[model samples]
Target: MIADSEIELHASRLMVMQAAWKHERGEDIRHESSICKVFVAEAVNRIIDRAVQMCGALGVSADTPLEHFYREARAFRIYDGPSEVHRMVIARDVLRSGNRS
Candidate 1:
């Protein structure tokens, strides 16, 4: 049983994958999609951070993929509406739903 932190990271990746599938199928996942985007973006950064830690000095070096991943993950949040904005939207939806259970 691999109980590494990456397992949670994979759950984030799966959220994105499910969102993509829903989009491809023309399903309306707007509010939920924003939540997934926020989750995945944050998760990618966490996963990359763990990778960098595991690789030690090589992680930050230009010669390793860890460096590339770290660099790219920084832009993911910005390109797709940013996590803050998405979280706000999610919160708005929850409040609007009025199903506070």
Candidate 2:
């Protein structure tokens, strides 16, 4: 889980960078932005969940900020737009572009 989370974190960072690059080039980045948002939100939640699992009960205790972080991370999925909605946006874009194999 930890390894997967780390890999996803790097991938998500790259996705954001690519989206930002597109935006800088005066390209419409709505699709890329939605993809980045969804990917990063899910990645953050997964990473925080793994941290909580690894720490066991201590993860939720006030002794650590894991619980607080977990709640905030979860809220990320709903901020701006929910993951499901962003997913719909991505799917619509892909289908409209006929980008599937």
Q: List TM-scores for all candidates, in order.
A: 0.81, 0.93
lDDT of 1 by residue, 33-65 (tens): 888888778777887888898888998999788
Models, CA RMSD each: 2.8, 1.5
Identify the candidate with maximal TM-score: 2
Over 11-38, each residue of candidate 2 has an lDDT whose tens digit, in order, gives 9989999989989999999999898899
lDDT of 2: 0.91
True lDDT of residue 89, candidate 2 = 87
What's the TM for model 2?
0.93
lDDT of each: 0.81, 0.91
